[model samples]
Target: MFMRAGLTIGEFSQITHLSVKMLRRYHEVGLLEPDRVDESTGYRYYSTAQVPNAQVIHRFRELDMPVREIKAILATPEPEARSALISEHLRRLERQLDTTRAAVTSLRRLLGPASPPLQVELRTSAAQSTAAVQAMVDQEEILRWYDGAMTELDAALADACLSQSGPPGGLYDNALFTHERGSATVYVPVTATAPAIGRVRPFVVPAAELAVTVHHGPHDDIDVTYGALGTYVAEHALAVAGPVRETYLVGPPDTADESAWRTEIGWPVFRTGIRVSG
Candidate 1:
């Protein structure tokens, strides 16, 4: 019997830098099959032409691509389709990287010296009518809901020929934070009456006295500011049971730079001349 013209599995592994064990696992998963298999000895042989293919698989694995996805990429014949698959995976990796960066930033801020005292002011907000969208949203879905609601509010105002009188704001029920799900209302204040359309409705925001603080930069670390403001309210003022308010003073609509974004976080409060004793 004549042996096939190919490098043995060991030689292929040495050239590709993929461990022999990994090569066997990849084969088992149908990710990267050997060019030839000796029927009698069960020995695997790879062609020199498959070197680039093995290298490509190694790179994808390093990127944490799933074996199934790598197999799909290899099986795809069209260049455009293969590129699309890779691009989609790259996008997912980018999102994961962003999340990791944000978490690191938060951890560093927490571990560092105590942040400067929060600049909080007591202010009264007057009742106003606006175009709004309200929904019961889970904490994990808050960002998605906020974006959709804001867009809907914008479109509703435009369709009604109404001019926005103030920056966009949101009211988040305490249950949302405490229980991970609750009512959420986002609105765009308008001078004229807003007509009801779709999820957008004419809603009136009641007046309230708030202990407000400005959270600079991105929303990722906004919770730190929230904690500071809560502490301040607990120490010097009386907190009222009401939905928290957030006004986007300068946001994504105004600038692509997240560092320039400023959000006003308002905690409902009632000031009595008495400070709480701990």
Candidate 2:
């Protein structure tokens, strides 16, 4: 016997514009529940009083809130706490939107009708001692890994009172491009020996002559530039052996706008056309 429960599952679905399957899933996840369940016939019913709650849940779901987070937001008795939780999710959505917009802009440039010519340079870098962090990382996690490693190196350099000699750079093994998983090292050139502690360690980045090219803007379509540069190297018979190097000319700790970022991609090469055996 149900009191004040006139709405059957179908009727409730119609009123809330929520699918029965979704409502059932919400009930299974303990996110929402029916007002009554008939034990004999296995029928479910919702009361009119629960309609507002269901509507709110649907709105939260439309905003892409996870079930557990939605449950927490619903369970918070204080209005301010509930609002804060929703606000946090909104901020995350805003950040995601920004990334999406940047990617869209990058895609347009990459897929545009006119292709731009790449400017490649051959420059030799001298060997330098630096504070660095190295790890075998997945391609998908490289961004997060780089951020963490860079922060650690910066703190270590500051603690040791080491002055930066040049821009921050990274070495990415060929496997990263070919197999999508490989070792990566991020280093900040320091004036003197750095205290090797935790993931931060002393490393000498070997000198090499590189076929260099500047990749302008965000890294979303950086592979295009890499391809062009690699083609240039191949056409000119400048191929050599070593991991690829990336120098962050204008990047984070300098600006947040990806449009303002500038990265220099370098592929190792030899001075003469004679291919030196690796």
Best by TM-score: 1
Tens digits of per-residue lDDT for model 1 on 48-154? 99999999999999999998899899999999999999998997788677677767777888899988777887888999898889999998778778888888888
Candidate 1 error regions (>4 Å) = 1-5, 14-17, 48-56, 71-88, 235-237, 275-278
Consecutive 10-residue window with the lowest summed lDDT within model 1: 269-278
Clashes of 1: 0
lDDT of 2 by residue, 186-237 (tens): 9998888878888999999999999888898877778778878888788778
| Deviating ranges (above 4 Å) for candidate 2 | 25-33, 39-41, 48-60, 63-103, 256-258, 274-278
CA error at residue 41 for candidate 1, angstroms: 2.9
lDDT at position 256, candidate 2: 89
TM-score of each: 0.80, 0.77
The 10-residue segment of model 2 with minimum total lDDT is 269-278
